[model samples]
Target: MSFAPEELLACALARLIVARPTAHVAVGAASPVPAAACWLAVKRGAPIRLSLLHKRSGNPFTEGSRELFDLTGQGRVDLFFLGGGQIDGQANLNLIGTGEWPGREVRFPGSFGSAFMYMMAGRTILFREEHSPRVLVERVAHVSAPGVSEPGVFRRGHAQALVTGKCVFAFDPARGRFILESVHPGETVESVRAATGFGFDVAAGVGETPAPTEGELALLRGPVRDEMLETYPEFCGRVFGRRAAA
Candidate 1:
């Protein structure tokens, strides 16, 4: 059977998570769609250091979100994944306003602690489900979080690997440039170009991203899915309604 977009995205994210080196913890925000899906990599038996941020002390969780920030501050987190409303060739992301600003053409959800996480994390993984000229642009409207303000420092700390509907890319360390590393199944260089708004470097003889393995599917259908249902029962209830119980 063919995999749906969500399943394709889930598998791709799972693969990316598996590729990351181990760390003490992995912190994802309230919107855990990507995080939950990617957790399958760990489920599939890929080694990873991960834990969910349920809530704060005295509020209701085993550990607080502060741990994530503190760990990153000390350079403990090895990898993280983030979605963006807009991205550039430099991998500088924008999750804030879209148009002229304040009361302009379009407005978007403000940056959700992206500034701190992007600045302090050891490595960042960026993915965009919708790949189109408007979503991937030459430059962002504003720097929601500074990627490389004065060059050397921020640039070195910020190593971004971007995955989109059509292709996968990693920023070149030398110039902090985004270079196409691989194309997804059935995707071509031309298709990637047509989807993106800016120019990006493509590696010579780039290959297709490997498909997800059986192990990954089991992980998604097992512990990971159950945990999400239990941990976010209210959210799940909203999606599936009261019928979720049956």
Candidate 2:
């Protein structure tokens, strides 16, 4: 039984969430993988939380997951999962526009509260559903959220791990830069690099990201699914839609 790319990516992300002891919250859109990871972490007894916004009200997640919004403001959120159209070596993300000529390329789904969350969330885990040079670029046309910036600036919180289809990366806190942390099984650093335009530091010995255990899958399918269905309709739609697609 083989899984599709998005499923594989989601399962890998679930494993990464399990690996981190400090992670208490998993923040991402209603995407399947991120949602699955967050749900799995919760069932694994990691005090997981979700995010949701009202479709008609436009209120900031008034009902779906209050735990996450409260945690962010109180400085309790530790880990968040995100994806973007473009990311830089510094781990900065850009989901704002296509960047053809500032406002020309393509308008994107607004930066889905990334700027607000990134400003306070202590750590983040970034993932890309697809692995391609265009998706993993050297620079971003716009700065949707600053991953790493100078001291005393707006963004100081860190983007801890980036889980891509090809590999995983960890950020160096001192310089606020990214270092290759792990490559998924059957992937190579050279191949991963071919997708990127700029250079990033690779750790001495990059290992393969571990596969998800049965426990992880169970957790994702059980409590997380039930909770979302009970609480968040839009999120449930997005997650179930993507999972069905996969």
Candidate 3:
């Protein structure tokens, strides 16, 4: 089955989540893709708990992000999703803005609890749809959240992988560099390297990302897609399709 990029990516991310099962997974704002992936894992029968901070309904937290912070701080959440306006080779995230701080060229929704979550969560997956050199930079103009905290800085964990439109990168915190995991279909390692601003190591046997299977597509379009509509009606309509005649 020919799957859309979003569906393929959802399957890819779901596989990642399934490989390393986590008890509790937290989905943050502007992360419909990751949220869909988490739900897909569950629908596929991978036992894991999903917390959707962006969802209007089905979100258990009545006090908003405060509870999310509490869970991360307490190490109750095993996985969390993070995104950035810019991400560097070292995995540092810049959600604040571009140029100098406080007075920048572009302003994003300034870093709220990202710094805390990035440091607190056992595993954080960075997802971004755009993979151009502009978005993947050699170094961010501003550091909203440092990827690898300084020694004795009290960081519990760091990024595991970065999923983008073109490829998937596994971050090696010890090496402080990203390793090209796999390139999506219709994209080459050379193209991904050319598009990225920073340097990274390509695995010896790098391969194309596996396409979404017919079964996976069925699940994604059915239950997985339905669950997303409650939290992301626009996204569901835009990527999957509009609900059945209301």
Best by TM-score: 3
lDDT over C-alpha atoms for residue 98 of model 1: 78
Candidate 3, residues 42-139: lDDT per residue as tens digits? 99887887888877766768776698898789999889888999999999999999877852798888887888999999888899999999899999
lDDT of each: 0.67, 0.67, 0.88
In model 3, which runs have C-alpha deviations exceeding 4 angstroms?
A: 62-64, 242-246
Structure candidate 3, residue pairs in collision:
none
Query: In terms of TM-score, how similar is model 1 to the real structure?
Result: 0.81
lDDT of 1 by residue, 88-152 (tens): 87777788867776416567677776787777777777878678988888898866765455646
lDDT of 2 at 172: 72
lDDT of prediction 1: 0.67
Task: Estimate the TM-score of every prediction.
Answer: 0.81, 0.77, 0.96
The true-structure Cα RMSD of candidate 1 reads 3.8
For candidate 1, the per-residue lDDT at 109 reads 78
Task: Give one digit per residue, the lDDT tens place, for model 2 in 108-209.
Answer: 676887877777777778877677877777787888888776767765367777777788887776776778877777888888788766578999988777
Error of 1 at 102 (Å): 3.7
Where does model 2 exceed 4 Å of error? 21-23, 49-71, 100-102, 154-156, 221-246
Error of 1 at 162 (Å): 0.8
Quote the lDDT for 144 in model 1.
76
